[model samples]
Target: MGDSIGFNVFSFFFLFFLTDIAGVSPAIAGTISLIAVLWDAITDPIIGFISDNLRSKYGRRRPMMIVSSVPYAVCTFLSKEIRNLFYPRNCLRI
Candidate 1:
């Protein structure tokens, strides 16, 4: 699905962003990514259930998408621009 693509692309770019530009160690970057994977794994099914059994007028996925649009747009734009705009050394490095 389209939603899944967004996550996959973000993860692909984000790992490089963390390790290369952010100066995080490879180990730390992998751990951070693993944490995200675990969280996604845990939340996806619960959210799916909630959306499936929801009583909203818009129903199911639409309402979630509508609510998530703002954050998603902000994050997507920010992620796309991060590699060019900033590279803070000794800031987030481990």
Candidate 2:
């Protein structure tokens, strides 16, 4: 649930950041976002396979989830902050 919520929030804000704040054209922004979605589609199953095969005392997903949480949160926060700071207001006009 948390992961889904985070992804939703990031997806909403990231599109605005690209189109409005970063002054990217809507078409290009859409293309870039499409590429990211495609990459996720390609990588997710491979990552799942690798993690499924991982053997450890802490178990496969648990250790990776724990290790990833901090970095993921930090990166998400920093990325949003950097974008906000760099573009105080929306730069692109419709």
Candidate No. with top lDDT: 2
| Pairs that clash in candidate 2 | none
Tens digits of per-residue lDDT for model 1, 21-79: 67799999999989988999999999989888988778678888898999989987987
Which residue pairs of candidate 1 clash? Answer: none
Model 2: per-residue lDDT, tens digit, 1-94?
Answer: 9669977887888888788767799999999999999999999999899799988899999987988899998987886567456655664333
* Candidate 1 colliding pairs, count: 0
Task: List TM-scores for all candidates, in order.
Answer: 0.73, 0.76
Model 1 lDDT on a 0 to 1 scale: 0.80
What overall lDDT goes with each candidate model?
A: 0.80, 0.83
- Estimate the TM-score for candidate 2: 0.76
lDDT for predicted candidate 2 compared with the true structure: 0.83
